[model samples]
Target: MSDRIIQSNKEELYASCIKRKMEGWRLAQICAVTINDGFEMSYTFVKDSDMDTLRICLKEDEPISSITQIYPCAFLQENEAAELFGVHIENITMDYKHKLYRIEADTPFKAKEDA
Candidate 1:
């Protein structure tokens, strides 16, 4: 099937992720919430049009995908996941640089911190 992309609300995205996982879709990339206040999650997959590309926006909870079982290459994506949204991946090998918050760690978020 051809690849299809869609934007989903926070709750819808989480549900979609679960639904896709049940269908055995592997997690591709997790682009952090650069413009969505860390509430949006971007995911890519190798599936049919009905389940190809999905964008989920999560409000308070950070969702995680155990794609390591499906694709070993997901490690990098997992790292990026943490680096972008500050979502912790369970049992996944991670370090400082991979932490999303640390990406801006060098730069203070407040004027006082910068001072």
Candidate 2:
């Protein structure tokens, strides 16, 4: 099935997620990329065998609202993103407290340019 991706602003993140969930979309994955001055987060959802992604850009220290309230399965992926990319995810149902990884350096996946 074809995949659809939509860019979303921070202000619309929660509402967008809620709308998707109400439409029977399941959270598939949450991915993050370290950019020059920030991080780009993608929330992928699946429905009817098709995939949809919601993309949002955030500054290095920006805090993102956790979607666990809408998709409980998002806890792990959101924690991983927080630990590896240093994107602060707020109100996580079960936050790993940024301890998802035991690496020497925090935010190990963050690009040097963004660090």
Query: Of the candidates shown, which would achieve the greatest lDDT relative to the real structure?
Result: 2
Model 2 Cα RMSD, Å?
A: 1.8
Tens digit of per-residue lDDT, candidate 1, span 1-115: 5777787654465567667778877666655553344345567776544446667655434555544554566667666665554554555543345544435453232112124
lDDT of 2 by residue, 6-84 (tens): 9987789899889989999889899999987899999999999799888999998888899999999999999999888
| C-alpha lDDT values of all predictions | 0.56, 0.89
Candidate 2 residue pairs in backbone clash: none
* Top candidate, metric TM-score: 2
Which segments of model 2 are wrong by more than 4 Å? 113-115
Instruction: Give me candidate 1's TM-score against the actual structure.
Output: 0.50
Relative to the true structure, candidate 2 reaches a TM of: 0.91
Q: Point out the worst 10-residue segment of candidate 2 by lDDT.
A: 106-115
